[model samples]
Each structure stands twice: as structure tokens, then as C-alpha cells.
Target: MATFRAELVIRNASVFYAHRFTRVNLAIRSGKIIGVWEPTVAGPEAEEIFDASGLYCFPGFIDPHVHFGLQLGSENCSDDCATGSTSAVFGGITSVFNFTPVLTGAEDELAALYKEVSQSTERYRTNLFMHLTVAEPKISPKKLVELALRYKFRSIKVFTTYSSSGRMTSDGYLMDLFKATRGTPLVVMVHAENDAMIDFREKKLSSDGPVKASHLPYLRPTISEVEAALRVCLMVSEMGGRLYLAHISSGKTVTELYRHFSALLGKSIFIETCPHYLYFSDAFLKGERAARFTTCPPLRPEEERQELLKHFYAGRIHTIGSDHCPFASWVKEKYEDDYLHMPNGLAGVELGFVLLYNLLKSRENEISVEELARMFSSNVSTAFGMFPQKGSLLPGADADITLFDPNAEWKVTLDTLHGRNDYDPYEGLKMKGKVDSTIIGGKFVVRNKQWVSTRVS
Candidate 1:
């Protein structure tokens, strides 16, 4: 496998740039993109070859935030590396940053989980990376950095919302964490919704009787997100720690990022938003649809959605994440009246690229597919310090590439999709452009717009 050469080659493809899509031919050698050269430079001794038939060549997308540690015992979420990577490949993603927290109740079990991953590297399809949420017991930020400087996790997650002792860390503790991890090149991903504010709002909502649709946005007000964002940004700024505001849904929070942004070496602030925030607003959840659209950092009004898109167009937002939590939609059926009880998070991993693809094309001939690549693949890799090697088509880079057909048409249906979650928020939505094929480390894991998941030496 180490000496493999050009197992598959696609010529005449529209190469995707961070902001536009263009034409190019990609050559592979031993699972690395040896060159992006002309067809005349293509070597005939390659194991296999194909004329892309005019498809879009994209560096495989990276989903910067995902939770694979979620467990339901025997009914555990069906997205382990095998299925998770299969789904990612379907969306043209060759790398994933799976988020794991020190398990809430079982502090001693952290080592076991770590061992499981360490022992099962080949069981996964794509090149998987991870971020461990630092726990006070085993992973205080300082110790976490030692683990990182030794073991090297790409990032660490911190929760500011949940009140449970194991979930959310105190602000002072968080500040110490930033200071401790400073200069380690560890990326701190924050779930920035103020716990105290949410507690106050929850009490108020409980006193207000049956939670109605009107209380959806009221319960988790924008103030909670804004205040948390401000505080976290201030902490990072003061201590000079690299921070990525994870799953930023509010336009108000994202709008202030630049004003709040300061870098020790221009590597301090990164702002990421989810598709749910960009596509569906609070308005989409009114009436019976409320349960369907539930997600943390509650979705805002349609106007805010428009504003968020504007932020992307203006380059204020750095990356887009699915934040693809997959609690069954029926688990939310009880929230028919009380929006407070409705489950948070909607599934969109499978639709991450499609939705963004649609948004890029709709901008009145403005943003091109190349820029889309930058925002999605290139920018995320750059933000997390994994670029050039994992996020480009340049020579010696991992041959992680996705080919999309800009004119490719596909209808997303529950039957054709694969996720442990039974429902899709983007269900019934027809989308344009899709991954025609996906290559992971020079392996054709997906071909002709379908997943060909298998063991690759």
C-alpha cells in the first residue's frame, strides 16, 4: 500500500477553489496527490484512470464538529467510524473531527474509550481526527495540553451551557484552561450558550405554564449566546489562546466576531455556523414543525438567516458545520406544545455540502464553487492547522479529494440516505450539485455518486 501509484485518476475535472471551481487534472502517486498537472503529463502506468466526464474536483470536505461518543447502549447511535465515514464519503468528506467528551458519569471509562479508538484505526474509512472535551477530573485544560503535546488531539471542546457537574466548566476554570493551553497550538471549541442565563429562562418558562411555540426563541434568548460569545472571546483575547466559536447560530454573535477577534499570531479566532442556522430560522419551527427544527442556540428569525448568509458572503464566518446531532425526531414529538421540552439538534451531516452548494449557486452569479471550497474545505483545515497536507490537491498531500458535478441533480430521500437517525431535517428538499466520487488517501471509497465503503490496506 505504501508504494501504490495512481489507483484512480480523474482528468478534465473542474477543480474547486476556496471561492470558485475550475478545470484541472489530478495525478496521484502512492495515495498522495503528486501533482495537479495536464492530461499530457498523465502517466499511463497508473493502476487506473478515468476522464472525469466534466465533474467538479473538490478537496474532500472536512466536518470540523461531530459527536460520535453519543451512546444509547444496544440502541447506540448507528454512526461509528464505519457508518459515519460512509455518510461522510457520500457528502464528499474524507476527513472528520469526531468530538468526544470525558463521559459524563464514568470518569474511569475515558481510558477505555481512548483505547477502543487506538485499537480500531483501520475499522474507519476516512482519515478521522478528534477533539476531547476536557473534564475537570482527568483532563483539566493544563493536563489536557500535556496530553495534547504528547498525544496530539487536533482540538478540545468546552461546554458553557449544560449545568451538570460533568458537562459545563465554570468561567474561571475556563479562563485557566485558555491560559494553560496557550501556545500549545490546541484549538479550543466552545459551545457558547450561557448556563446561568438558560437556567433563569428555564425557570421562567416553567412558571409560564405550557410552553408554546412563541416561547421557542424566548426561552433560549439571543442574549445567552451573545454574552457567552463575548466572554469566551475576551478570555481568548486576554490569554491569547486559539479559539473556535463552535456552532454559532446567531447573527448577532457572528457579527461581533471580527470586533472581538484578536490573534496572538493571527491564529486566535475562528467562527463556525451550522446549516440549521443558515437554512432554517425560528419561523420554520412554528406550529407542528417546531419539534422538527429544534437545535441548541435556537434558530433565529428568517431575517437573521439572511444576515448569516450575508456574513458568509462577506467572509465574516470561517466555516460551516452540520453539528449533526441525531436524536430521533419522534423523541421530540412530545414538544407539540412546549418548545422548552423539545429536543435540541437536527441531523444534517448528509446534507452539509448540498445545502451549501445550493446557497453558493443562488447568490446571483456572485460566489463560485472555488470560493465554496475555501470556505468549506480549505478554510476549516487552515483554521485547525491541518491545511496543505489534508486540505489541498498539491503534491505530497493526502489524495483526499471529492469530485462534484455542478449540474448533477439528486433528490434526497430517507430511503437512499444512511444515518442511525431515522429522519432528516432536509427531508423533502431537492438539492442541486453532489459528490460524483470521493477518494480517501488515493482509494476510491465512493464512485459515481455512491458510497463504496470497504477495507483499504
Candidate 2:
């Protein structure tokens, strides 16, 4: 018998696998996990060893929805590939899935958009995947399938609102998209909000007086999301298509999902909620600095927020994406009074894992570390068709992993985070769990809470 030698070994850690945590030693070679064995079972010899005692090793976190280098009109998002991905790695994210440029009614724009996105990959510190955005109904189903196969992307994003911005897709087109991608690896990702309902509400609200940030809830009410979600569910059910609903802010929508289509969940349909929705309420949009909390499908009321949390604890929600699109403070400040035109997003990629971990730790009996790994890593990878390879600790998987300190305590501050943005939405909050190190492809990108990767200069 020959001795097995590994390039790297992580020893004496509580490694999450098969929905449970167990003490194990992981051996890696050439950026792949080759062995996960009991410490008592004579582990392979390694050239280098990492003492992971007292740490919990999880599959590296994945932020399934992020907007890096996103542009809206003349202004651009503050974080680009290098800076945004650096922030992600610091947050324990080893892979990110972002969106491609909006595909309007033109076929010619596809090639150029592909080139632009492909060229931007060199700046990414984390593994990057993209979802094609279909803005208009002019794109054919054949074209979408062809693009999905050619690019190896597994999802397409479409908006049901933002009609004024020309990003809204008609119900007819959505149905066609669903029917087209049925029985395929592609999942239809929808920004579920009724455009006509929003427009009507906005018009009605404006008739009363000038709309401020506080009026955000009134402008884009929960009913809009609930209605649109039901519509999407019906369409997917009829057409037998897979779906991923993005940034669900309303608990009422979750209730409606279970009431009507509970069986579809974790099967044909998946739901995603953001940290902001779980933490902040519509009350945050009332006073000065409210613009900072402004995001699409605006934060819900306290009751709804609490309800959403209850469902998450009940295991209804599938994943948590940062929805991390941040503008400089100046950009948000400029729209302080004119929130109707304000950009809709928040920055939390760096805080998402800690936020969820802290919440779960507070109610340790309700959720386990294994479930957290599923929401932050495995479930997302499964939904997006990257499982086993990108989201598991099993042999033959990528050696991407996150080491977390379950007892570490820290407060959110500008000094504790990294990004190009000038402000953090989660600033001033205390966090219990902290990411001690992040490994991608068997290499340390973040060690001892510090980034050491030169890949994203």
C-alpha cells in the first residue's frame, strides 16, 4: 500500500456534510477535495497543514444575486469586478452570480454584451457566473436557449415592473420563456412586481402630494408582489418551468405561495430573500437618511418583516442573496428628497453570512449550522446548477471553503469592511459569528480575517 500525500490538509475541524457537522480532516490536491476522513483514520500526509481546531468549515458561501459594475443611465454602481469581488471574498463568498447587460429588442446587442462580460472576468477575485437579462419581448425562445447553452449559464432574469425603463416583460413573453426553458437546466428568475399596479399606485399617490421616501411602501405595496408572485407561480405551474423569485420582501407573498403552490417550493419554484428584508422594516424609510434604505420592492412593515422571519425559520425560504447594488453616499444623498428617481439597492454582500448566522445563533434550537450552509451555499448551487462542484465538501468537489468562528464577536463599522462604497447599510450593528478565513480552489484568499489575494488588483 502506498501512502497518500496531499498538497494541503485542513485538520481537526467540524466540517458540514450531508446536513450535519462532523469532526474530519480534508485533504486537497490541485485545487480539488480528494478526501474527507475521520481524524482517527490515519489521514494522508500533507506538505502543508492548516490547524482548523475550534472552527467550523462550511462550503464557501455563494452570493447568487449581485450587480457588479452595473450601470444605470449616466451613473454606475460604486463596486466593479475587482472591488466588489474583493468585498465578497472578505464576506466569505468564494463565488458570485451576477447579471449580464440588459438585452433589449435587438439581436445584434448579444455578441457585444457577451464580449463585454467575458472581458470583465479577469478582474473578478471570486468565481463569477452570469444570468442573462431579457428586457423586452423581442428576443425569441430559440435565441435564449442557444445563448444559455453557448454560455453555460443556467438562469435568465426578467422584470415584471420597470416598464417605464423598458425592462418589463409582458405576460405573454414570460409564458413563452417558461414554456421554452421547461425541462431544461435554465431557470427563469423574475423580479416579481406588477408594473401597471405600481404605476397606478404611484399616480394615485402623486395626486395627493409630493411622494417622499416614507411613501415607498404605499407606492410599491405588498399586494403588487403578492399578485405578481401568484401570476408567476401560475405560469410556471402551467408551463412546467423552473423559477427563482428574487429579493422577496413581503411575507404576504410567502403565505400566498404556500396557500396556493406549496408543493412547488424547493421543487419547481425557489424563493430568495435579502438580509435587509430580514433586518430592516418600512419604518427605516420614514426619516432623514431614509434614502439609504431605499431598494426595489421596498422594505415591508414590521409585521410583514417579522412574518418573513418566521417563514425563514420554518424553512420556507430557500436562499439569501445580498442584492448588493450600492451607490456612493453622495449618489444616494443627491436623491434624498426625490426618492422616486432614486436607485434601488443596498450593500450587504460582506455582512450577509454574519447577519444570518447571528440571527440563527440567537435561536439555535430553530436552525442549525447545516441549514445555514444550505441557504448560503448548497441550496443556491443546486438551484443554479452548480452543486456538487461548487457547493459541497465531498470528494471531487472544488476546494472552495469558508472557516467560521462561531464565538467571535464584532460590530459593523467602516473599518471592519472593504468596498469602494462610502457607506455600509449594516453599519453600527453587532455580529456574533465572523469569517476567519476563505479558501477558493485550495488557495487562501482571506486568512485570519485579512485578504491576501493578488488576483484582484
Candidate 3:
């Protein structure tokens, strides 16, 4: 009688599934999950065994939106893919979806894409996926379609605001994009905010005094997000294509979606919210450190934040992304007087797992460990078309897994975190949970909260 052997076996892990966690042992072979057994099952011999008795094992987290190594305005983000993905793996993320430079219809498009892919392979440690960011005017629809179909890029992201970068894709151009992706599995992601409304408010508000952080929500009002959301949702429904709203920050936007949720359910409209929107309010922008909290579609009032969380717990929110675009402290320092000049992103990927865990713990009745797993991993993978390959722990799935200790305690500080960025927005915040280990493709990236294979040095 021949006996089967696993390459690696993990014992006594609380594996997350559907809406519950079950204690199980996992067997891995050649970078695939070969078996899922009851905790007491010990049928196979393995080359290596890891005991994870007190830990919760989740599918490796997949962040759907991250801007690693991308240049924003005059400066680049502090962390490139290698450094940024290192931080991500420390927080249990094993895969990420980032953007490439806007497709400019010039230069060989395929060549540019190959270069981007090569650069990613060289720079990122985690499994990296890319979305082509194309502006309305600069893109050639046929070329875009060719690229998407050929490379399986699977998603095209267009901003409804940020006209300064010529990224504003108007209704007409958006229709064209939808038309291009029709009858395909490809999706269109939108950064929805009314450009005209934001420009008007910023102009009116800055005229009086230096644009302060407190003025962010006012400059890009909830109405702006709601209006743009309504438009994009309608376009997606009318065009019969998928649409994803990125970094949704307003209860108003949620309310609008809720009104039409039933009709849009099978229509493929997904909503993603960020941790900052869930935890902090616009008041975080009140003091001298306002620049630190500045993000596009800026933080809303406390009441709105609560409402958004309610929607999240009710299963209305599709996924939670970090929108992790980090810059050095000096870049944030450059915009002391005016909010508009402040870099429009924050770093949170390394803190997202714990921060969200604490939030769900406080509201246990509304969310469960399994649901949190879906939001952080499975849902993102399904949306971006990386489902069973990257987000599942079932047999035959890729051996990407995260071991977490719900009872462990940790602090958010520069010394404790691994990203290249110099600032920690979550500084001084105490978390009740910690990442115990992270595995990517059966290889240990983090073990016992210490770096293993992913460390560059």
C-alpha cells in the first residue's frame, strides 16, 4: 500500500469559511492546498509541520486598490512594490491590485505593458495584478480592449474627477468604455466625485483663507460623491457592464445605492470603502496635523461614518480596501498651509487587518470573522477575477494563507511597522489582534511575526 505525503502540514487552525470558523488541519503540496482535514485527522505524513493551535487561519488577504511605486503629481509614493508588498504581507495580505501609468495612445502600448509587467516582477514580492488607468481622451478603445483581452488585465479604472491629470472620464467617454467591455468579463472601476462641484467648492473656500484640512469634506462635499455615483451606477446598469466604486467615503453614496440595491444586485455594481473612512471622521483634520488625514473624498462627519459602517455590516458594502498610497513625512510637510496641496492619500495596509479586527470586535453582532475574511480577501479576488487561485483555502487552491492571533496585542508605531514610509497614521493605536504568520504559495513570508523569505536584506 502506497502512502501519500504532503510537503507541509498546518495543525489546529481555525479556518474561516462562509460565516463561521472551523478548527481544521491543512495539508499542502507543491504550492497547492492538497487536503483540509478535521483537527484530529492525522492520516498523512509531511515533510514539515506547523502547529497553529491558538491562531485563526484566513485566506491570504487581497487588497484590490493600492498605489505602489506610482508617481502622484510632483513626487512618487515612498514605497515601491517590493517595500510596500513587504508591509502588506506583514499584515496578512498576499496579493494586491495596483495601477499602471495612464495609457497614452503613444509609444507601443503592448511594449509599455510588458515593461510594466517586467518591472512588477522585479519589484513586488507578493502576487501583483494591474488595472489599466486610462483617461477618456487619450485612450484608444480598440487598443484598450486588445490589451485587456490579451493580458487579462480584467479591469479599467477611470477617475470622474482629477481633471488636473486629465483623468476625468465624462459620461460620454464612460459610455464608450462600457461599450468596449460589454459582453466580456472585464469590469470598469470608477473614482467617483463630481469634478465641477469639487472645483467650485475648492475655489470658493480657498478664496477666504488657506485651504485647511477641515475644509476637505466641504470642498469635496458628500453631494459630489453622491451625484457622481448615481451617474456611474446608471451608466453601468444601462450599459450592462460591471462597475466598482473605489474608496467610497460618504453615507450619501451608500444611501443612493441602497435606494437601488435590488435592481443593481445582479448588475455587477460593487462598492469598496476604506479603513480611514470607517475609523476617523473629518474632525481628524481639525488640528495642525490635518495634512496627515487628507484623502480624496475626505473623511465625513461622525454620523456619516456610523451610517457607512452600518451598511458595511448589513452586507451592503462589497469590499474594504486600504487605498494605500503612502508618501514620506516631508511630502506631507510641504502642504502645511493649504489642504489642496496636501498629498491625497494615507498609509494603512499594514494596519488594516488589526484595525478592522478591532472594529468588528466592537460590533460583533453585525459582523463575523468569516465575513471579515471575505471582505479582506475572497470578495476582492472574486471582483478582480483571481478567486480560487488566490483567495480560497480549499483543496487545489493556491497555498496562500494568513495565520492570525485574535488574542495577541500590538501597537501601531514606526518601529513596529515595516513599510518605507516614515509616518504612521495609526500611531498610538492599540490593537487586540496580530498577524502570526503569512504564507504565499506554500512559502513562508512571515513566521512567528518575524520576516522570513520576503526580507530584501
Candidate No. with top TM-score: 2
Clashes of each: 11, 0, 0
What's the best-to-worst order under lDDT? 2, 3, 1
Q: In model 3, where is the ten-residue run with the lowest total lDDT?
A: 137-146
RMSD of each: 3.3, 1.5, 2.1
Q: Is candidate 1 or candidate 3 better by lDDT?
A: 3
lDDT for residue 258 in candidate 2, whole number 0-100: 95
Residue 421 alpha-carbon offset, candidate 3, angstroms: 2.2
lDDT of 2 at 374: 94
Off by over 4 Å in 1: 1-5, 17-22, 40-44, 72-81, 103-110, 119-123, 138-140, 210-214, 262-266, 335-342, 455-457
Worst 10 residues of 1 by lDDT: 69-78
Question: Worst lDDT window (10 residues) for model 2?
Answer: 136-145
Per-residue CA lDDT of model 1 for 1-457, tens digit only, reads 2233566667877776434555666768678887565555544346678678768788888988765535532224436666666677788878878866454433356566577667766766777787876555444667656666666677878888777345886788788878987777678888898888878878888886887655768877887888998889889878767888888887877766655563432358788898889888888767665676777778898877887888776657778887776666666665667665455666777778888889877883766556667766888888788888877877778888888877877777888677777778888877888778888888888889666668545
| lDDT values, one for every candidate | 0.73, 0.88, 0.82
lDDT of 2 by residue, 1-457 (tens): 1368999999988899766898888999999999888887887889999998889999999999999888876668989888899999988999999999788855567777788888888899998889888876466876776776677778989999988878898898889889988878899999999899999988887788767778899899999999999999999999888999999998889989999999999989999999999999998998788888888889999999999999988878899999999988788778776667777788988889899988898888888778878999899989988889988999999999999988898899988988888888889998888899999999999998887887832
lDDT of 3 by residue, 209-269 (tens): 8887677878888988998988888887777678889999977789888797557742488
